[model samples]
Target: MAIMLSGHVIGLLKEYMQDLVEQARQETSAQERFGFAATVYRPDHAISDLLALLDDRIESEGMQVGLPEGFLHEIWSLCNQASVHVADRVYVESNVGSEAGSKARTRELTYRALLAFIEARGRASAQGEQGVMES
Candidate 1:
């Protein structure tokens, strides 16, 4: 069975993902400014970053924010399920630029892939609901 997330939960997730993406951008910019070597980044790293964020949020403000119980686990499972799809999307985008900003680009691509997965799931769930209602 698939875990369904409500609009509120999805909204919160988007916010969290944006925060991570922005943090990556800042980190990349700082590294470039400081002449630090760019570290190799990939979709798996982005997924781990998101899962870490979710874990922290669930521990810190899960109840206050009205996150459903098992939310973190559910998201973890979803990430695993979507991993290949996300990685493919990220890989298709040519990584042919300065390595300094590659981390930020990877993060953005990963976030977008995850967002697309969530959106597709939401639509499918909605359509299923509609079908049931019509039945």
Candidate 2:
């Protein structure tokens, strides 16, 4: 059975994914600015620590950070339900008789859906910010 994801769920997923992408972008930008050092005093240090700090700042206000285990569990459970629902509604079984092919198709569909969601959310966020600036 194929799962059908609603417009709202897709939208939410896209928004969430976009936020993650933007966060990664910002982290990269920050790293470019602050990652290098004049001296190799601490070459053993990981860039991940710096990235984590940047991520923390990015999500400091009006955003969630380091969600508790219980909250994460709940969110995962909900996401699983949503995925199942969507898969059942939209996924079509391949007649090629190849399990790998079916799995690949499903993965492709999932990735495309995620990308669409991210693009939509990024555009909406940009528009909202632009509106705020114009006001």
Tens digits of lDDT, candidate 2, 1-135: 122334554454445544544554465466659874332211112122223433454456213433332433333343344454434433443333355332224433443443444445456667887999999
Once superposed on the true structure, which residue ranges of model 1 sit more than 4 Å away at CA?
Answer: 94-101
lDDT of 1 by residue, 28-131 (tens): 78998999988889999999999999999889999999899888888888899899999998887635544433777888888899889988987998899899
How does each model score on lDDT? Answer: 0.87, 0.41
lDDT of 1 at 45: 98
TM-score for each candidate, following the candidate numbering = 0.87, 0.31
Report model 1's TM-score to 2 decimal places. 0.87
Scanning candidate 1 in windows of ten residues, the lowest lDDT window is 92-101
Q: Ten residues in a row with the worst lDDT in model 2? A: 39-48
